[model samples]
Target: MGLLTERGELEAERLTPAGERILRAASTLFYERGIRTVGVDAIADAAEVTKKTLYDRFGSKDRLIAAYLEQRNRVWHAFLDDQLAALAPQTPADVILALFAALTDWMAESRRGCGFINASVELAAPDHPAMPVIVAQKQWMRSEFMAQAALGGFADVQELADRLLLLHEGALVCFRVAAMEYAPEVAHRAAADLLAGWPRD
Candidate 1:
């Protein structure tokens, strides 16, 4: 979704004012509530536009979902970049580990859990319009982890990244499903242990 651009906020020139409002309304409602549970009418009402306007702008609810997801991915990536800049992590290991803190902040902001994961569960169709956006978000996260592992001088960077990605996703699930506030902390500790044993060469 956001892999294409650094601009994720609604102000990006890609959408018209009304279109942006529609997407913004859908993003909040869909995340706060389930995507399927919130219909086009509700989104239109929330955005203060007619349902015809929504269909004309987005074409359909499925496409709207994709747009919303793309907007969210862009916002999330922008946030991570900001956080990374603020931390000024000296090493790849520091950057990777520091992502846990970022995740914790994200979790607090998004009490319902990962929006991509939630949409996947609700949509249930691999061929849905939003699937590409969802897949892009995951692929970007995994690839970033791999790049970080390589930067950290891990000999088995691919395998290390695979494990780290697993832990990262698992923590998101655990936090959402089990409602565990410390899931990211546990995942970070586990990642630290794994990194400790990996060959640095």
Candidate 2:
């Protein structure tokens, strides 16, 4: 967890409807326009709250972005967990393929790219408060991939993880730039071929 700027009084549960409104507006605006591009005043306008109230609730723009990333992280992790969970009781190879299917479904939705990857580029500051949260998300994702490989009985779990990480990140890059969702299919096929040749323990 990144250290927030100030020990702000941002208790999410205690947030008023007005505060929720601010969060909702921030989520939309920040996702559409990168975090740095959307100013505090713009968020205030979108949320229909005065800048004073926004500051009173969240303290700083950086804190607000951190809150947004945290919120987004929760939602995305739930989706990934649910999809990965469905692959249980199958061979790890099958589970890996199922994971790619879930990724394909995720890419079919419009305007959804890997949020952490996008945020990293936009923030550009190494010590930016958002970096820790993004780093955690990536670390967790890779660990989950590795664990799945291990469960599948693969002896070389680390190598499989490395290859899948490349495939997964490359797929996201393709989706972001070319608006191509086919990377999932291509990557899935390549992964399937790799697994086919690997000796099962």
User: What's each prediction's TM-score?
Assistant: 0.92, 0.84
- Counting clashing residue pairs in each candidate, in order, gives 0, 0
Best by TM-score: 1
Worst 10 residues of 1 by lDDT: 1-10
Candidate 1 backbone collisions, by pair: none
lDDT per residue for candidate 1 within 22-52, as digits (tens), equals 9989999999989989999999999999999
Flag regions of model 1 displaced more than 4 Å: 1-13
- Please give the TM-score that candidate 1 achieves against the real structure: 0.92
Query: Against the hidden true structure, what lDDT does model 2 obtain?
Result: 0.75
CA-only RMSD, every prediction = 3.3, 5.9
CA lDDT, every model vs. true structure? 0.84, 0.75
Per-residue lDDT of candidate 2, residues 1-201 (tens digit): 111112222234467777888888998888878777889889999999999999998888887787788777777655666776665535657767776777787777636577778888898898888788778766665666687788778878888778887887788788887787688888778778887887666
